[model samples]
Target: MAFEQSLRRPVAATIRMIVPAGGAKPAPPVGPALGQYRLNLMTFCKDFNARTQHIKPETPMSVLLTAYKDNTFDFIVKSPSVTWYLKKAAGIQAGSGKPGHETVATLSVKHIYEIAKIKQTDPNCQTMPLESICKSIISTARTMGIKVLKELD
Candidate 1:
Protein backbone atom coordinates (compact mmCIF):
# COMPACT_ATOMS: atom_id res chain seq x y z
CA MET A 1 0.00 0.00 0.00
CA ALA A 2 2.81 2.40 0.83
CA PHE A 3 4.59 1.70 -2.46
CA GLU A 4 1.42 2.21 -4.46
CA GLN A 5 0.69 5.46 -2.71
CA SER A 6 4.19 6.69 -3.41
CA LEU A 7 3.66 6.07 -7.10
CA ARG A 8 0.50 8.14 -7.18
CA ARG A 9 0.62 11.89 -6.94
CA PRO A 10 -2.29 13.62 -5.23
CA VAL A 11 -4.28 15.74 -7.64
CA ALA A 12 -4.43 19.45 -6.90
CA ALA A 13 -7.10 20.34 -9.41
CA THR A 14 -8.58 19.62 -12.81
CA ILE A 15 -8.91 22.71 -14.98
CA ARG A 16 -10.91 23.03 -18.17
CA MET A 17 -10.56 25.99 -20.50
CA ILE A 18 -11.00 27.02 -24.12
CA VAL A 19 -7.93 28.76 -25.51
CA PRO A 20 -7.04 29.88 -28.99
CA ALA A 21 -4.66 27.64 -30.88
CA GLY A 22 -1.06 28.87 -30.67
CA GLY A 23 -2.33 31.85 -28.69
CA ALA A 24 -1.71 30.80 -25.11
CA LYS A 25 0.01 33.54 -23.13
CA PRO A 26 0.76 34.02 -19.46
CA ALA A 27 -2.24 36.30 -19.11
CA PRO A 28 -5.85 36.46 -18.10
CA PRO A 29 -7.54 33.08 -17.97
CA VAL A 30 -4.46 30.91 -18.38
CA GLY A 31 -2.34 32.84 -15.92
CA PRO A 32 -4.99 33.24 -13.25
CA ALA A 33 -6.20 29.63 -13.37
CA LEU A 34 -2.75 28.04 -13.24
CA GLY A 35 -1.31 30.65 -10.91
CA GLN A 36 -3.87 29.79 -8.25
CA TYR A 37 -2.45 26.26 -8.25
CA ARG A 38 1.17 27.55 -8.22
CA LEU A 39 1.89 25.86 -11.54
CA ASN A 40 4.48 27.30 -13.91
CA LEU A 41 2.67 29.71 -16.18
CA MET A 42 5.43 30.21 -18.74
CA THR A 43 6.06 26.49 -19.07
CA PHE A 44 2.39 25.80 -19.73
CA CYS A 45 2.05 28.61 -22.23
CA LYS A 46 5.12 27.53 -24.19
CA ASP A 47 4.18 23.86 -24.28
CA PHE A 48 0.55 24.54 -25.19
CA ASN A 49 1.49 26.95 -27.95
CA ALA A 50 4.01 24.46 -29.33
CA ARG A 51 1.56 21.58 -29.34
CA THR A 52 -1.23 23.59 -31.01
CA GLN A 53 1.02 25.28 -33.56
CA HIS A 54 -0.20 22.99 -36.32
CA ILE A 55 -3.77 24.14 -35.90
CA LYS A 56 -4.96 27.44 -37.36
CA PRO A 57 -4.23 30.39 -35.10
CA GLU A 58 -7.16 31.79 -33.07
CA THR A 59 -9.17 28.59 -33.46
CA PRO A 60 -10.55 27.65 -30.06
CA MET A 61 -8.95 24.51 -28.61
CA SER A 62 -10.39 22.84 -25.55
CA VAL A 63 -7.84 22.00 -22.85
CA LEU A 64 -8.05 19.54 -19.98
CA LEU A 65 -5.34 20.26 -17.43
CA THR A 66 -4.48 18.20 -14.40
CA ALA A 67 -2.51 20.06 -11.73
CA TYR A 68 -0.65 17.95 -9.20
CA LYS A 69 0.13 18.79 -5.57
CA ASP A 70 3.81 19.04 -6.38
CA ASN A 71 3.20 22.13 -8.54
CA THR A 72 3.54 20.04 -11.71
CA PHE A 73 0.83 19.67 -14.34
CA ASP A 74 -0.24 17.81 -17.45
CA PHE A 75 -2.64 18.90 -20.14
CA ILE A 76 -4.38 17.51 -23.20
CA VAL A 77 -5.49 19.71 -26.05
CA LYS A 78 -8.60 18.87 -28.08
CA SER A 79 -9.59 20.06 -31.51
CA PRO A 80 -12.05 22.84 -32.15
CA SER A 81 -15.71 22.28 -31.32
CA VAL A 82 -18.20 20.75 -33.75
CA THR A 83 -20.09 24.04 -34.04
CA TRP A 84 -16.95 25.85 -35.14
CA TYR A 85 -16.32 23.31 -37.87
CA LEU A 86 -19.94 23.41 -38.99
CA LYS A 87 -19.98 27.16 -39.26
CA LYS A 88 -16.72 27.18 -41.22
CA ALA A 89 -17.87 24.50 -43.64
CA ALA A 90 -21.14 26.34 -44.18
CA GLY A 91 -19.34 29.68 -44.65
CA ILE A 92 -21.63 31.23 -42.04
CA GLN A 93 -20.77 33.50 -39.17
CA ALA A 94 -23.27 31.90 -36.79
CA GLY A 95 -26.10 29.41 -36.50
CA SER A 96 -29.69 30.30 -37.20
CA GLY A 97 -31.56 31.64 -34.18
CA LYS A 98 -34.61 29.51 -35.07
CA PRO A 99 -32.69 26.28 -35.87
CA GLY A 100 -35.22 23.77 -37.28
CA HIS A 101 -37.61 26.54 -38.25
CA GLU A 102 -35.05 28.38 -40.36
CA THR A 103 -32.16 26.98 -42.41
CA VAL A 104 -29.01 29.04 -42.49
CA ALA A 105 -26.79 26.90 -44.71
CA THR A 106 -26.45 23.49 -46.32
CA LEU A 107 -23.72 20.83 -46.22
CA SER A 108 -23.17 17.71 -48.27
CA VAL A 109 -22.63 14.13 -47.14
CA LYS A 110 -18.98 14.50 -48.15
CA HIS A 111 -18.62 17.44 -45.80
CA ILE A 112 -20.07 15.33 -43.01
CA TYR A 113 -17.62 12.54 -43.78
CA GLU A 114 -14.68 14.92 -43.77
CA ILE A 115 -15.70 16.45 -40.47
CA ALA A 116 -16.18 13.00 -38.96
CA LYS A 117 -12.73 12.01 -40.05
CA ILE A 118 -11.26 15.00 -38.30
CA LYS A 119 -13.28 14.38 -35.14
CA GLN A 120 -12.19 10.73 -35.04
CA THR A 121 -8.66 11.87 -34.27
CA ASP A 122 -9.83 13.07 -30.87
CA PRO A 123 -8.75 10.70 -28.06
CA ASN A 124 -12.30 10.30 -26.73
CA CYS A 125 -13.81 9.76 -30.18
CA GLN A 126 -11.13 7.40 -31.50
CA THR A 127 -13.17 4.35 -30.54
CA MET A 128 -16.46 5.71 -31.95
CA PRO A 129 -17.35 4.45 -35.42
CA LEU A 130 -17.08 6.90 -38.29
CA GLU A 131 -20.76 6.42 -39.10
CA SER A 132 -21.67 7.20 -35.51
CA ILE A 133 -19.61 10.39 -35.62
CA CYS A 134 -21.25 11.42 -38.90
CA LYS A 135 -24.71 10.85 -37.46
CA SER A 136 -23.86 12.98 -34.41
CA ILE A 137 -22.55 15.75 -36.63
CA ILE A 138 -25.71 15.62 -38.72
CA SER A 139 -27.81 15.88 -35.58
CA THR A 140 -25.82 18.92 -34.46
CA ALA A 141 -26.22 20.45 -37.90
CA ARG A 142 -29.97 19.99 -37.66
CA THR A 143 -30.11 21.75 -34.34
CA MET A 144 -28.02 24.59 -35.75
CA GLY A 145 -30.37 25.13 -38.72
CA ILE A 146 -27.90 23.65 -41.18
CA LYS A 147 -29.22 21.28 -43.84
CA VAL A 148 -27.38 18.15 -44.90
CA LEU A 149 -27.89 17.20 -48.53
CA LYS A 150 -27.09 13.95 -50.31
CA GLU A 151 -25.02 16.04 -52.68
CA LEU A 152 -24.53 19.64 -53.54
CA ASP A 153 -26.62 21.07 -56.38
Candidate 2:
Protein backbone atom coordinates (compact mmCIF):
# COMPACT_ATOMS: atom_id res chain seq x y z
CA MET A 1 0.00 0.00 0.00
CA ALA A 2 2.76 2.41 0.97
CA PHE A 3 4.68 1.69 -2.20
CA GLU A 4 1.60 2.19 -4.33
CA GLN A 5 0.79 5.49 -2.61
CA SER A 6 4.30 6.84 -3.06
CA LEU A 7 4.45 5.85 -6.66
CA ARG A 8 1.04 7.34 -7.43
CA ARG A 9 1.71 10.75 -6.01
CA PRO A 10 5.30 11.58 -5.21
CA VAL A 11 5.49 15.11 -3.87
CA ALA A 12 7.92 17.49 -5.50
CA ALA A 13 7.33 20.56 -3.31
CA THR A 14 5.12 22.00 -0.64
CA ILE A 15 4.22 25.68 -0.92
CA ARG A 16 2.64 28.13 1.49
CA MET A 17 1.24 31.43 0.26
CA ILE A 18 -1.22 34.15 1.20
CA VAL A 19 -3.29 35.07 -1.83
CA PRO A 20 -6.12 37.54 -2.06
CA ALA A 21 -9.57 36.04 -2.27
CA GLY A 22 -10.83 35.70 -5.85
CA GLY A 23 -7.75 37.53 -7.05
CA ALA A 24 -5.52 34.77 -8.33
CA LYS A 25 -3.70 35.80 -11.49
CA PRO A 26 -0.81 34.50 -13.52
CA ALA A 27 1.45 37.25 -12.29
CA PRO A 28 4.41 37.82 -10.16
CA PRO A 29 4.06 36.00 -6.87
CA VAL A 30 1.66 33.32 -8.09
CA GLY A 31 3.23 32.99 -11.50
CA PRO A 32 6.89 32.65 -10.57
CA ALA A 33 6.23 30.30 -7.68
CA LEU A 34 4.07 27.74 -9.51
CA GLY A 35 5.63 28.28 -12.93
CA GLN A 36 8.97 27.02 -11.67
CA TYR A 37 7.27 23.75 -10.76
CA ARG A 38 5.67 23.49 -14.24
CA LEU A 39 2.22 23.47 -12.69
CA ASN A 40 -0.56 24.96 -14.84
CA LEU A 41 -0.99 28.47 -13.49
CA MET A 42 -4.30 29.09 -15.27
CA THR A 43 -5.89 25.97 -13.84
CA PHE A 44 -4.88 26.89 -10.33
CA CYS A 45 -6.00 30.49 -10.71
CA LYS A 46 -9.39 29.53 -12.10
CA ASP A 47 -10.01 26.94 -9.41
CA PHE A 48 -8.80 29.15 -6.57
CA ASN A 49 -10.81 32.14 -7.76
CA ALA A 50 -13.94 30.05 -8.08
CA ARG A 51 -13.52 28.58 -4.62
CA THR A 52 -13.03 32.00 -2.99
CA GLN A 53 -15.72 33.87 -4.95
CA HIS A 54 -18.05 33.83 -1.98
CA ILE A 55 -15.52 35.52 0.25
CA LYS A 56 -14.97 39.26 0.13
CA PRO A 57 -12.47 40.25 -2.52
CA GLU A 58 -8.95 41.20 -1.34
CA THR A 59 -9.26 39.19 1.87
CA PRO A 60 -6.01 37.39 2.53
CA MET A 61 -6.40 33.64 2.25
CA SER A 62 -3.84 31.18 3.48
CA VAL A 63 -3.14 28.39 1.03
CA LEU A 64 -1.14 25.18 1.42
CA LEU A 65 -0.18 23.64 -1.92
CA THR A 66 1.40 20.30 -2.66
CA ALA A 67 3.07 19.94 -6.06
CA TYR A 68 3.52 16.37 -7.24
CA LYS A 69 6.37 15.06 -9.39
CA ASP A 70 3.97 14.74 -12.35
CA ASN A 71 3.39 18.53 -12.36
CA THR A 72 -0.04 18.17 -10.76
CA PHE A 73 -0.99 20.00 -7.58
CA ASP A 74 -3.47 20.05 -4.71
CA PHE A 75 -4.15 22.85 -2.30
CA ILE A 76 -6.15 23.70 0.82
CA VAL A 77 -7.50 27.16 1.46
CA LYS A 78 -7.63 28.18 5.10
CA SER A 79 -9.79 30.95 6.51
CA PRO A 80 -8.41 34.42 6.92
CA SER A 81 -6.32 35.21 9.96
CA VAL A 82 -8.01 36.05 13.24
CA THR A 83 -6.39 39.47 13.25
CA TRP A 84 -8.04 40.39 9.96
CA TYR A 85 -11.45 39.39 11.25
CA LEU A 86 -10.84 41.29 14.47
CA LYS A 87 -9.81 44.44 12.68
CA LYS A 88 -12.80 44.28 10.35
CA ALA A 89 -15.16 43.75 13.25
CA ALA A 90 -13.66 46.66 15.13
CA GLY A 91 -13.53 48.90 12.01
CA ILE A 92 -9.89 49.58 12.58
CA GLN A 93 -7.15 50.00 10.01
CA ALA A 94 -4.47 48.56 12.24
CA GLY A 95 -3.73 47.36 15.78
CA SER A 96 -2.61 49.64 18.57
CA GLY A 97 1.10 50.18 18.75
CA LYS A 98 1.19 50.16 22.55
CA PRO A 99 -1.39 47.38 22.92
CA GLY A 100 -1.99 47.30 26.66
CA HIS A 101 -1.50 51.03 27.14
CA GLU A 102 -3.48 52.14 24.11
CA THR A 103 -7.04 51.07 23.51
CA VAL A 104 -7.94 51.01 19.82
CA ALA A 105 -11.42 49.56 19.71
CA THR A 106 -14.05 47.57 21.58
CA LEU A 107 -15.73 44.28 20.67
CA SER A 108 -18.74 42.74 22.34
CA VAL A 109 -18.95 39.07 23.34
CA LYS A 110 -21.28 38.48 20.42
CA HIS A 111 -18.62 39.67 18.02
CA ILE A 112 -16.09 37.31 19.52
CA TYR A 113 -18.51 34.43 19.30
CA GLU A 114 -19.28 35.20 15.67
CA ILE A 115 -15.63 35.33 14.78
CA ALA A 116 -15.08 32.07 16.62
CA LYS A 117 -17.87 30.43 14.69
CA ILE A 118 -16.36 31.52 11.41
CA LYS A 119 -12.93 30.33 12.48
CA GLN A 120 -14.38 26.97 13.44
CA THR A 121 -14.89 26.26 9.74
CA ASP A 122 -11.14 26.08 9.22
CA PRO A 123 -9.72 22.55 8.89
CA ASN A 124 -7.26 23.07 11.73
CA CYS A 125 -9.89 24.50 14.06
CA GLN A 126 -12.56 21.91 13.19
CA THR A 127 -11.21 19.54 15.87
CA MET A 128 -11.05 22.24 18.58
CA PRO A 129 -13.92 23.19 20.85
CA LEU A 130 -15.77 26.45 20.18
CA GLU A 131 -14.88 27.79 23.61
CA SER A 132 -11.18 27.22 22.96
CA ILE A 133 -11.41 29.14 19.73
CA CYS A 134 -13.22 31.99 21.47
CA LYS A 135 -10.56 32.16 24.15
CA SER A 136 -7.79 32.40 21.58
CA ILE A 137 -9.62 35.13 19.69
CA ILE A 138 -10.15 37.07 22.91
CA SER A 139 -6.44 36.79 23.66
CA THR A 140 -5.65 38.05 20.18
CA ALA A 141 -8.01 40.99 20.65
CA ARG A 142 -6.31 41.94 23.90
CA THR A 143 -2.91 41.93 22.26
CA MET A 144 -4.31 44.21 19.54
CA GLY A 145 -5.62 46.59 22.23
CA ILE A 146 -9.23 45.81 21.47
CA LYS A 147 -11.40 45.53 24.55
CA VAL A 148 -13.93 42.73 24.82
CA LEU A 149 -17.09 43.94 26.43
CA LYS A 150 -20.12 42.03 27.62
CA GLU A 151 -22.40 44.43 25.79
CA LEU A 152 -22.04 47.24 23.24
CA ASP A 153 -22.75 49.98 25.77
Indicate which candidate wins on TM-score.
Answer: 1
lDDT per residue as tens, model 2, 1-153: 988876778899999889999999999679988999999999999999999999999999999999998999999999999999999999999999999999999999999999999999999999999999999999999999999999998
Q: Summarize candidate 1's per-residue lDDT along 64-102 as a digit string, tens digits.
A: 999999999999998888999999999999999998899
Clashes of each: 0, 0
lDDT of each candidate versus the true structure: 0.95, 0.96
Task: Give the distance in Å from residue 151's predicted Cα in candidate 2 to where it truly belongs.
Answer: 0.9
